[model samples]
Target: MSGVAPGASAKGTAARTANESAPVDDAEVVRDSRPARRGPGGPMGGMGMPTEKPLDMRGTLRRLLGDMREHRLELAVSVLLGVASVVLAVVGPKILGNATNIVFAAVISREIPAGITQEQAIEGLRAQGQDRLADMLTQVTFTPGEGLDTHALAVTLGWALLVYLGAWLFGWLQARLTAIVVQHTMFRMRARVEDKLTRVPLSYVDRQSRGDVLSRVTNDVDNLSMTLNQTLSQLVTSVLTVVGVLVMMFWISPLLAVIALVTVPLTVGVTSMIAKRSQPQFIRQWRTTGELNGHIEEIYTGHALVKVFGQTDTAQRVFDERNDELYNSSFRAQFISGTIQPAMAFIANLNYVVVAVVGGLRVASGQMSLGDVQAFIQYSRQFTQPITQIASMMNMLQSGAASAERVYGLLDAEEQEPDPEPAVRLDEVAGRVEFADVDFSYDPRNPLIEGLSLVAEPGQTVAIVGPTGAGKTTLVNLIMRFYEVQAGAITLDGVDTRAMTRADLRGSVGMVLQDAWLFEGTIEQNIVYPIATSPGAPVTPEQRERMLRAAQATHVDSFVRSLPEGYETVITGEGGSLSTGERQLVTIARAFVADPPILILDEATSSVDTRTEVLVQKAMNALRVGRTSFVIAHRLSTITGADVIVVMEHGSIVEQGSHEELLAAGGAYARLYASQFAAAAIED
Candidate 1:
């Protein structure tokens, strides 16, 4: 049996990967390989953790948001909540300033002589030549003996607390809603990618990096989901906070507001520059991660072969190289993105310093009250808080976007040709398969098969024997339409196969691949898979009876009955606990139950022992009754018994006839036969 190799798929274009690419017949199993942290709280909680601008940042963002359009309602509500939250947060500082003014004014008011009118006190201070002091006192609002209106102060402080609490509530709600939106969007995105995989052509898949495709599906999707959730929640609020706080700052004192605003442009420029440096690294990190995953998956899946061939050290060395590459890129991306937060903090401090010094001067000049100055200072900090958050979020967004673009590339990949309209039906008795002047190629520059014509008449067994890369599997690939023919037509029962839907054409044929592939399921399920997959597979009272008969016929019943579960035995990972010969028998049983008019066996007996081969050969004989069978044979016994033996060399038919007729001709088939028997003689 041909074993799975990395980059071979059990099915055509399953993410364009396979655990089974083999030179045994040049046919591969199209296998689709579908293959977190926090920190710091309580004692000063939470500073937690791309962009050389993504190659197509705007396009990626637009597409991502478009995918999220279905959740617009939730997003809209979240945005509204974010805006309301900002409003409350912005007003909180102003309200607390009022409370501070109340207490400070009451304290100042008590210092004035008791029972003296406010104007008289101011005049007395002016008379004493304390004009500046008198002028400052005029701005204070308090009655004599007020002495810090504890009740009023308590009321003002309560309002401030309510505003702050309200802000938190809205923000929490906004975050919750945004989480829902992001999760659903991610859900749809994942589905789209999975669906896209099935439609991806094998040619496209093979040409693309398997590791990269895997990363897009796994790592990139996850990064996008995470970044979107975290970024979206705060993104709206942060932006609105910047806008709202700016308005409040300007209202409190335009001069100080302008100074605070100056830091914004500088912050943006710094973030942009840092992002440009980091983005490419983030992309590289993710890309390298995919490459590592691909390599690991390739080696690990085929580990038995690796060990058998003693290439473990080689595999490990390759892994180390990729692992090291991943580390360097990840470190650079993290290191560069990491600098954003601290740099933003520094800029915020500078802005705070500038706004503080100027506001203090305004307060001293009596142009602004201590309360107004306090509010402006608070607003200045609030303004930079959101800007800094946005700056930090940019790193995350860029990383996610890089992943997003990768995913989009997969989704945007050219899909397979759609099944034909008005498809021809093939539910007839006769099975005459013909390849008429068929021309095909894996690469246009290198033609593998040119002007090849062949036919398998009804109930005839045609055995194809050839050297490796002699276009044996490639011919089968064309007939099966795994890879389309470049020129000429393939027909079944006088009807062009292309005119028939792929499903219908394939349904009319049964294939026993070299790998004898089976999934994790009950033995009964495995045996019936081919039939079960067909829409017309009869599910009658005799379905079980047919399965039992097929199992018994294939010698599968003998061993299966020995097991406790019989047909109910569960096999995992390509027939767990079953011998390779047994797996081959299971596939034969599958084809037996399918009972298609045409049977294509790729070295079906290669896995069975000599003794078992006799029984399997008998079972195959029974299964082939009245069926047009094409065998890609590897043994003399298989080729000599065929009604027709076609000798192939370098993509052309060198000789074709029955064993006796070809042996009499003494051409390519004779040489092939002589070589095979000679090898057997030497072994003897």
Candidate 2:
């Protein structure tokens, strides 16, 4: 039987012949090697801020607040609970102070002795003796003052209990809210990153290391999650503590409060300056860590290659360089962040001394009472605690911000827009494909295939032969719509391929490529991939019988039957257990099981030996009986009987005819055939 079935082409074979017989220009022969463009990623803050520019703390906080507002109800509740807890806790110190003041005032107003002068009253206590007497008086004085009554004590105890309850409640709520937010946010961020990855062009993934992408998704998000869970809530509590304590300080003694403000700003400014410097270091640390991960992943994947090439020393040196840099960055970040707490502590101690000295003089001069000075001292310590805490939390916030920015950068990437227009759905297809004046390039500036056109009729076998980089694989990529055409139309059975949904288009078309990737699964599972898409599509005994027949046709049935589990034999990842030829046969069987109307074979039998090639070619003949097949082959002998031959050079088809016609024409194909099969010709 003739290979091609009789079918009318909208444009006859003469038009196809004219399309295939075009000449190539020398300018189009030299191809550009640069990969395609993909959208970039970074923080929402634009990328150009100089490294010298100080960190924008306000901007960082704004971003954090914006994220929190995503779950405003929970944040509001947490904040309210946090403020209430701080208020009750601050009241503890205030009540304690009032009790001391009551006792000290009684002593002051008691007319201690008729002979005791102002100097004698001052000399009545040692420098440190005042602190000791203050402690003693606080325990003694609660008997009579209205503020220290049973009602107040009961209320203070009740407030203390409420403070404990509020801390626990806020703690629980913060944990719950953090769990909900981080899980949801991480899920959303991962989804966004995945969406961007799918649409941002395939070339980007090829150029960027998989390890770097993995680090962004895994390590960076993990760091952000940890920070959000702990540092964020601590930050809120610290701010509330500082605000509440400051208020109490002003109430007890405005003089002490003003002196406290002097150190507060200084500590904050110094910490802010240090944190700003360390932010870049943290960013650098993560970047270096990412690079290290990439290297480790590469070494793991290509261990055999490295060993065989004796490059272990070189690899180790490279790894050590990145590792050492990461260590240095981490050390600098930790060391700088660590200094803030001690520096703030030193300042806090200095302020404590100043408050004690100034408040002591005021008390001695009778401008302030002794109890008021004690209360002021208590307020001073309370104020400093929060300041110290804020400084420490601020360091964490900087680190978290750096990590969050990296994560958010990935989430914010713009993916390639899907076709807005709805697509046509095809239930079944008559396999006829046409390419009209197609122009394509991975890089738009340089065209790979320019003004080329061709057609394959129903049940016809069309062989496309070309040199490397002659747009052979590019042609198949376009057919599969891995890329969109720059200026051209591809049609299937007179319908523009662009009008069909990619899912539907791919569903009806099957491909077996040079690399036959067999995922980790059973043999039966691999064969059933296409049909398995619809959960409702049930496979019956008859289908299994047909599948077995298909496997037999590809000569894989023998090998499979030999396996311990037969059809249930599991293939490891990438089919590592199988040889190249065996894997190819399994792939061919997969295509057979799908039984699509159209098949594209890109040198599918090249890995097999000649004897095995013939067996595979026989199976391909059976598979192609009622389908249109486009075959790309380097072994020209196998495709001698194809219905049409389209020979391409440097993205353009220079000459095309049947195998016999091309041999007779003595063009590029004739030369290739002569060079490849000359010795075989003598054997023939």
Model 1 Cα shift for residue 118 (angstroms): 4.0
Report the poorest 10 consecutive residues by lDDT, candidate 2.
Answer: 1-10
lDDT of 1 at 636: 66
Q: Give the best candidate by TM-score.
A: 1
Best by lDDT: 1
Tens-place lDDT digits, model 2, residues 401-482: 7666766656554444365377766667888899999987654555568898999999999998976556666677678666
C-alpha displacement of 469 in model 1, angstroms? 1.3
| Model 2 spans with C-alpha error above 4 angstroms | 1-70, 96-155, 353-382, 411-414, 533-550, 567-570, 608-625, 678-684
Q: Estimated TM-score per prediction?
A: 0.87, 0.79
Q: Any idea what lDDT model 1 has?
A: 0.77
